[model samples]
Every structure is written in structure tokens, then in C-alpha cells.
Target: MENVCLSEELIKSQVLCAPETKVVIHGEDCSVYKIENETGEGVITRYPVFPGIEILYNDIHMTNGVSHNEAPRPNVVEINHCRVGRFECEFSRGGSIYLGEGDLAVNVMTNITNQTWFPLSHYHGITIAVDIPVAESILKQLSEVMGKGLDFDLSAIRDRLCAKNSCFVMRATDSIQHIFSELYRVPQDLKDGYFKIKVIELFLFLNSPELVNKREERQYFSRKQIDKIKEIRQYLIDNVAQHITLNELSQQFNFPLTSMKLCFKEVYGSTINGYMQAYRVQMAAKFLRETTDCVTEIALKVGYQNSSKFAELFKQFMGQPPSEYRKSFVQ
Candidate 1:
């Protein structure tokens, strides 16, 4: 059996397809599953594709197998834009897989021939991270700049995708400054449209992308506090696989649990537990992106007792099943 990986631009903008142009896996009996958004974000529609078509937003990765169907149950919080979809499917192939995502669906191809499978489980979507106060305030400030007579706002854009700008704000306070600054300068009604998403993309492109390491002006915490945070960060780096409780961390660091939580907020811009979980998923993502290890092995490596739990958590964080992700990753 042969498996081909693809990463290509599809019919829709920002909708990425992976591994191969046409979806063909190892087997003809292997199948493609469709995940559709009947309504737009937060709006439930009877028919799933009513929301506007963006490959990732309304689309899902397709999969079917006969062996394991339960999903991981990791908590994923979203303030504005983006979703982490969770599916509990039981029967799936036990061989090499094919993966793709686009405006319509997530295509999975089997590597084996004439593979028949069952859909014993279902998938649920998890919302990603967002900073409401900040996003709203920025939206208001930007809207005031645009003269808020229109319906669309930066808040809406951030909501549509469950944007993760908290980390961005931690490093570049002004990362959003450009978007807000220029957005305020734009015509009023333009704010009604997706200038928010545009601003997000601008920030993502300028400060967040891996290829560009532009140094932006930043604000650091007080010196004494800074040292404490460095300790915490190092601890997390060293213990990414283990369970870290706030109380334990506080006792070791000599701060009251409350103070410790505040410090983590000030430094990382998210709760400690959320940070730990996100960090764990990120580490798991690294393994998925870099290794051909089975999901079970990766789950154990990331401190998950069971592979299904890891898969659910991974889906909630990255929006795809582990097998699907691995297929695209190796290719």
C-alpha cells in the first residue's frame, strides 16, 4: 500500500488540503467522512452548511474505521474565533491513512484496498481561546475609529474564528495596535465588514508567523516578578508531560496560590491549568507533526492514560483526529 501526503491550495481561500491533490489512500473500501456546519458560528441551523464557506471554519476531517470510536475529552475554551471539533467514532481502518481539508469537507483516504468500516461514534466541536474584554475593547476602539454605525465589528471577526490572540498580546501588546490603529483610520462602514479578521491576519503575518521574527516593542513585568515567572515557565518546560497543580506550584514557588495564579495571568495571559493543557497539546502536536508514532504511543508520551482521551483532546485543540493529523504530518 502507498500513502501520499499533500499540502496544496484548494478552491477556497485559506482552506488547505494536505498530502495528495486527489484523495486516494491505501484502500478503495476505506472512506471519506463529512463534517458540516449547518449554521454559522454559535448559530444552529437545521442544515449544516448554511454558514459561509471557509474550508476550515465550516469544514471537517472525514474518517471511518471499525476498531476504536470513542473521542478525547479535553477542555478547549474559545472567546472569539476558531473551533476544536470533537468526534467519537469507533470503527476505523488499522493502516496508513490519507488526509485533506477544504471548503466542503475533510477527506480521508485509506492505504489498504477495499476497506469497509463503521461510524460507531460522533464528533463534537470545541471552541478555541479568545480574550473577550481585550477583543471587545479593541473592537470598540476600532469601531469608534470607524464610527460604529455598521453591524460587523472586530469582536465579530474574533468570534467567528475563536481567535487565539492572548499569547500574541503577551508578547506584542501593539501586535494588535497596527490592526486597531489602521482600522480606526479606515472608512466607518468598512468596520462593519471583516476588518477584524483582516487585522488578525495582519498581526498573525507580521508577528506570529514562524518565517518572520520581527522584533516589536514590548512591556515586561516588574523585575522581581519577572524572575518568578521565568522560574514558572522553566518548570512547565521541564515538566510538560506531568500533571501540574496550581497549589503545588505555588507551594514550591513560595507564593500564595492566589498570587501565583495572578502572576501566571500577568505573565502568560491565561490560567495556569489552561496553559498546562494547551502546552501539553502543543507538545503532543509536535510529536504528531514530527513522528510516525501511533496515537497510543503519542498519548502515553504526553501523559494520557488512554489513546481515545488523547485523540479527543487533540481534536479539541487542533481540529482533526490524530490519525488524520499523522497522515498529513508525515507527508
Candidate 2:
């Protein structure tokens, strides 16, 4: 398929095509735009919550295939957090980064072209977009209100972003997660006002001296390394029943132990064992729902020898014991 460059106009004409999708305008520049797949199981909605701030919620599954899209937005900054499945992004210059669950990617678009892809055809997350000058003004007003110095240099951040080709991906801190969690729970009627407050909170957290300094020190990986790590991930998925260790994978793939550990975590946002355990549980859940197998049989199929251990892990991942989880469907 040919790669398409997405503009504001394209989002309306090409992307939001499902019959149930709708756009509501509140005022001149404030609007709520919603899009969904034909089944309504996947949806993406954007709310222009403030004059220069926009919040987008995504709960979408790309059942068709992978989508390769390019976005060219000038003088805008985007904060993308992956709360569920991971997504892969490629910069205009062949740079790539992956955002996994609880990971945040902050990027500034100033004459920059960035492309995004859904590796697993599923994503659920929130995106925050802010116009540069507007965000700067908001920060100043907030500083005055709180009586804290809140010394922030937006220009400096912009310079750094430009230096790095307008992208930085990091693990989401607890403070960041808390603010977003509160925003997610805010009542629908009060969303506009609450969004404003929460966005200010996000700015304060990002502007802290510690975070600002951390941004300067970032890891850069070669494209070759990223591709190799992705291959290793697929290998793990294919052999979920086998007990794969780091030493074994390193020797087989010819990757240094340290590089594999670091890159794997960056790409998948979890330790090797954690990622495998989560993936294994997901496979087990599929068996529980689709097949008539007993709990012990299902556990052994997904690599667990002890049925009791499998039940415990399944509860941790799926929030219910296997029997109860299956019963909910039957009842």
C-alpha cells in the first residue's frame, strides 16, 4: 500500500469514514471529533478542550492490516502515551521508536515529518497536542497562580527537540500516570474544564528541573539493532511454550547480553520474563474462551507445568481466576 501523508483535512475526509463516526463543533475552534470501526469495537475521539490544547482517546484495533501514516504538523507538540498495546513510529529520517504500555513519547513538529505504524494492529491510549506559543502562555499564567518560580524555557526544549529531530521517548513517571489517570476518570460533562486543569498539571510535571535534565541524556539505537530486536520478539511469540533465557537468546541471535537486555526493554517496555509471562497469559485466555479444555490442560498448553501456578498468574493478568473468568461468559 502506498504511504499517505495525513493532514488536518485528510483526517476528516479519509480517516473518519465509519458510518457511526461524527464530529461536533462547540465553537469556532473547539470541537469533539469521533471515529470508529464498522463494528464499533474500535474508536478514536479527539476533543479540543482548550484554545490551544487537544486531547485524543484511542481504543482501536486495526483488523484489516498495518497502517503506515505520515503526519506533518508544524509548530505543534504531541505527548503520546501508550496505556495498552504498543505502537511503532518511524521518523522522516529513518529513526524509529516504540511506545509500550506506560511509556510516553514527546515530540515537537516543526517542519518535521513523522510516520507511525501499529505493529500488533491494536492500540489504546491518549494523545495530548499543544500549540507551542499557547502552551508557553499557559505555563506563565500557572506560575503566577501557584507563586512558584516554575522557571521553564520552552525555547530551550524546542532547541533540544530540533537537535534530536523532534522526538524523545521515556518511561512514564508515577506523577505523570496519576495525572492522566485522574483525567480518564473525570466526568464527561466536566471534561472541558477538567482537561484544562490536568493539562496544566502535566506541564508542571514535565517542566521540573529533573525531567528537563533527563531529556538531555537519551539513548539512540541504530535501525539495524531495532530490526533485530523485533525479530527476536517474534521468535519468542512463536516459541512461547519453550523456556527461553537471555543467555540462550543472546548466543543464538549473536547479540550482546547488555544490548539485548536494553533494546528489548526499550522496544517492548517490559523485562524479558515479564513480557513473556504476559504474552503467555494472553494465549491461555484465548484457550479458556474458545476451547472446552480443563484448567490443567490449558495451563500445560501455554508452558506452565503446574496448574495452580498458572491459575495464580492468570488471575494476576486477567483480574479473575480461570474458572470464574470462563463462567462469566457462560452465565
Best by TM-score: 2
TM-scores of the models, in the order given: 0.36, 0.71
Model 2 residue 306 distance off true place after TM-score fit, in angstroms: 4.3
Candidate 2 residue-wise lDDT, 97-137, digit = tens: 77777777677664343444455567778888666666577
- Which candidate gets the maximum lDDT versus the true structure? 2
Compared with the true structure, all predictions reach lDDT values of 0.39, 0.67
Model 1, residue 130: what's the lDDT? 27
Q: Backbone collision count in every prediction? A: 41, 0
Model 1: how far is 240 from its true place, Å? Answer: 1.2
